[model samples]
Target chain A: MSKESIILLLFIMVLFIIGGCQTQELNESGVVAGLGIDLEEEELQVSMQMARPALPGQSSGSEPAFEVVSAKGRSLSEGLRKITLLFPRNPLVAQANLLVIGEELAKTDLALIADSILRNPSIRKNAVVVVAREVSPKDVLNTQVAMESLSATAIPRMLRNQERQMGIYQEVSLEEFLNKLARPGVDPTAPAVTLIDSINGKAIRLEGTAVFKGREMAGYLDSRESRGLRFLNPGRIQGGLINIPAPFEGPGRVGIEIIRSQTKVEAANTDGQIVMRITYIGEGNYYEQTGEADILRLENIPVLESICAEQIKSDMQACIKQAQKLKSDIFGWGNIVYSQHPAVWAELGPDWEEIFPGVKTEIKVEFELRRTYVTDQSLHYQ
Target chain B: MLGSCYDLHEINDAAIAQNFSLDLLENGQVAFLAQTTQPVPRSETGETQPSQNISVMGTGRTAAEAARGMFLHFSRLFLWIHANTLFIGENLARQDLTLISDFLMRNRNLRFQTCVYLVCGVSIQDIHKAMNERGFAITSARGITQQIETQAEELGYYTPLANIELLERMLTPGIEPALPQLTVIKEGDKDRIVLQGMGVIKNNRLIGKLNPEQSQGYYYLQSKKKQGGLISIAWSDSPNAMAVMHCTQFTSNTRPFIQEGKLNMKIDIKCELQYLETIGDDNIYVPANQQRLEYLAEEKIKQQVRSCIIQAQQLNSDILGWGLTTARYQPGWWEDMAAQWDQVFPVVGSQVEVECILCSDGLSRESFRFN
Candidate 1:
């Protein structure tokens, strides 16, 4: 090689060496799938749930069969740093799927918890957030799942299932919470998680939603009200069963798994009271049929429709009753007044909770079963 | 030889390709809306001058009007970023409004005029129609409930204030007749619908009148193949019992644009369900006695299914999303309809076709009991 060529080759080698040394890994490492934040006395406690690689002979049947570590510090970030101090592996959260706040932590100053989560660069803004109700969030994070290996993945999936099947607490991610923390008249909700232990085994149960009027916890909606909140806030996608009464089968019911649902909220001025109208359209499949009535009959559809309406009404009532009793705005009632009818909201003044209790809400639902996969309209008996 | 060498060097320099910077095609008028610390003054000579930098207040008519103006003014800035743009931000924070609005207005020469967001107190749908009057594009935010709450918190007004109390405390009765504020009163079966964005159904059909909650459920069950969520259910062990629950999260990852010709909204839901906080039994079996588990499962699912569908229905209107759907689904429509989206949303046609497949019957199916 020529002398100049030799020099160029050396320069190129140096560039490659520098590039290799500076390159960062794109994949998440030592990522804890689930994390729990709790406050004890004056210290902040952080619990992390991470999935460890299984041994060659180890089975991956029991999910969240990983490792859990915890530490306490003056702050959430400090607590997290303490975790890294104890473990050789660097903690990562870019792929974290859930963040659980202990019930006590959620009550007073959530802004501190929210700020720490928002400031983290590796944390995903879309990660689901929740409030632990029945027990410490760490317990729920440590619960074993039969399918997924990480409780982080399992917990989020379980919550997502609730959204699809039943619109309860509308899903709120870290990014979403930040945005809600900035609005003028609306609030946000995060689902509550609890660890359920029974003779059968252990499972993570969805309790209800935690309501935040702003950055502060206003109150919590009971599960039924959470259902109403879900119905009122259809932006979340939920899948679940809706049952209707069957006339021919006495007290028997027919179950349909909801494939899709949407809601329209209207705030209007009528007379002197604030009138809120919530109209919804739902579509689902007749997943299970136990009654004598034929599923294929077009005429029977109307009868089924009537039954469905009654069911929805009762469901909505259950939600409304809970919200009213609790004096919480999990359904975004304040939002409706503030955004749609600001003028009225302005007049209602400071006692929104008091007015909320008396505010009239009318829920209207529309259910349609557009298709039935069954080919035969009637079961033929020879 | 020296002359030739110099010529060669010049030729090499001239041969370098010129970098191409794509410029946006300029079109339409730009309007500025912002909440300023000082009121804008119109000159006696009929001259309009941009006055005082707007602080972007959370409330007040000036703030609302200014935010609306700034959004229109900043349309150009967004157009520059996305040359063939439709929707822009789904839900921008209140603090960021001033910057974004300023950016949009400064780029007045851009092709598109719409700067759609999930929730921008002001509507851009009408501006698009007036300017482009042609086809347009749109964008949206996935989960927006948090956005609304965040906006309020950012503005320093997180709590829901009782309007009457505030007004009563602020102004004495002698001042101005407290304007008769518009309110929605619902008594018994009647709900006074406000905001033309509201939709009503009766017996599962679009019967002009606002259907009762029960009727609305019937409409959803009859029209769609799937119920969105379960709101209430009876434990298989106790057929007469009911539990109220809610979904905390709902999300869908179906990009219908890539998979199918139809524009589909994907959904996944998570809920916190409550039923008589004290459950007599957590593990209740279906088919309590001499009956199939499927029989009870069917009944329990149908009852609360309709209730969950309502949330979905409201979202489809593009109102709940902070106008994100309008920004995504119909950018062109949003541009044309931005001004009146609030009014038009209620009357907008909402059709969501569904297909639900049950994957599990829980422990009830396996442990169903029959006498």
Candidate 2:
């Protein structure tokens, strides 16, 4: 063939190859916002929140934002495929933001669900993982959010917001959760979402943190305990408040806003016994004085600082006490020992679970009052 | 030059979305309301009329689905590229904002600069219904955006939050998001949409709110550019006596430092104000009174800033973005404390220093006193 004809042949071949590949238009595929996995009578029930874009030339605000279609099968992919039986569009899970696990399923085994989600090439690894508390995954997905269009999006945002504002729970992405589950020393944890009744109607709220042992959820941490867990984890909480009783003789309280904190977990071996020493250094401002005493004065700052330090130390102690009772080392104390004392971990690796419950922990907290905000004196009323 | 028009999208074939309002229905469905404007045909006299505004409502389990449900009622591709405003109902805002923010950020057509508002005390449907009944000339959402632009700087009651800014604050480690709030009030037979203070969002939910005064404190702390506002100071001895100062130029600098292994923030504020009015016999010509006036003004500002900080601490929400400042200036301290900044933020100490200069006393130097 001539040179020009050969080029023409190549162009035609490219078009043919492109035509041979499978393709779907915007209308042909359903855009998924979130997915819920549940177990019902030995079957895997999967729920998909599908986005329904407005039809061309259609007036706006006349249709629903999304439709929930669910199906049950023996496996995750099968259940997802079966969703097409009720919905016309093909299910697309790539853009999904949340993967909600039912309480029952999370308690049984998350390994199966984790494997399926990890194996799927379309699902993003950064999708948030949440456990439905006192509700099914489908119910969690069905909860409508006023601030956000999709519950899938709302759950993740809630997780992130809770992590920053409350410091009670941290959002666990699919990759992070799976990595912790598979890691040798540390276990995994996911935020727990529940439905609550409000003045308007039922609203979804992130209530606690779910602690997992291996692939199954061991228990949950309440808000205060969750804060304790967050305190131990480096870079998990950015801002939170601590309320302590008034240091002076008054029937009032003081609010201390944490400015910066550092946690140092050291594993020391002394005379054949392993001990974990957690040193927490915190700095805060004298935020509010709901008392009659003038605690903001420089003379009383040390007293106030010592009281705040005691409050934090007590919180850490309660968290450690609760963890021992639950027999779950969500704080990764084992991981610290493994890294700091490898020889010790080798001997206790097999029996770490039993040893974790009895392991001795010494927590020391030092809190300092940095400033008294804009005023050095409280308002004095006659 | 080598581009092909094979997939040409015609503007006439698409419906331009101007505004969106989201709410949660009683049946646990998302109510998505959108406003679009369409051009009217020319009259026989060859005079072109103004474009007509169309309101459409969609309901579904999620926001995207409700948007898609709009297609069942109308037949046109809803284009979001022109969408500029988002109104969130109080009921929905009290629940969570994750889904709405995700859809907005992930959607390719929607711009991140779109302004967001939290509707207080009324449903989005009520606002739309009231607007249509009153036959308002301008779009209420657009009117709100304009009002915020004009009044936010002068009044300092509330600050405008864009889609990207809200998302950044919500996602960033140390700070939380706060949006301008709107409420509809009935006046005579007409309903008016007014800008309230601000709705403080924490943990992706609306926990509390900041009144106009408190909101001004937030504005003072966060704003870096020159600001304009009026500050009123009361006489120390007399209850009724008051003096009003019109702020002409204002600037603040926040510096975070570690003093003796403790974090400390120093905020220095400098402003020039013109004395607008005085109720009592306070003379600006007198050096002692002028000095007293300056001192009182500083004290007033300090009180507002303090109250604003206290309010945030009480709500346990860091809307002031103090954590971001610490992280930016003290990277080493932040590296160790970033994870626990939330716990540290509410109690962080700061010193606020204000320098006020009375540049002018308007056209008069003293108050009018009858002899």
User: Which docking class does model 1 fall in?
Assistant: incorrect
Q: Write the per-residue lDDT of candidate 1 for residues A232-294, one digit (tens) a residue.
A: 774534454555555475533455556677788887779858888988888765543432235
Candidate 2 per-residue lDDT, tens place, A72-113, comes to 988888898899899888877898988888888888888667
Per-residue lDDT tens digits for candidate 2, residues B1-371, read 43555335466545677788898788867788887665444565665554556566766555655665454333345678777888998888887665465455545567888899998998998776665454333555566677787776676667788887887787786778888898889999788888887999886789899988888877777655336778888877677788888877778778888887777778887878878888876454455688888888888887787787888888888787777788888878989998777687777888989888988887876687767
Of the true interface contacts, the fraction found in model 1 is 0.00
Q: What TM-score fits each model?
A: 0.45, 0.53
Counting clashing residue pairs in each candidate, in order, gives 160, 59
Q: How far off is residue A76 in model 1, in Å?
A: 1.5
Candidate 2 stretches with Cα past 4 Å from truth are: A1-4, A7-15, A18-20, A54-64, B1-371
C-alpha RMSD in Å of predicted model 1 compared with the true structure = 32.2
For model 2, the local distance difference test gives: 0.75
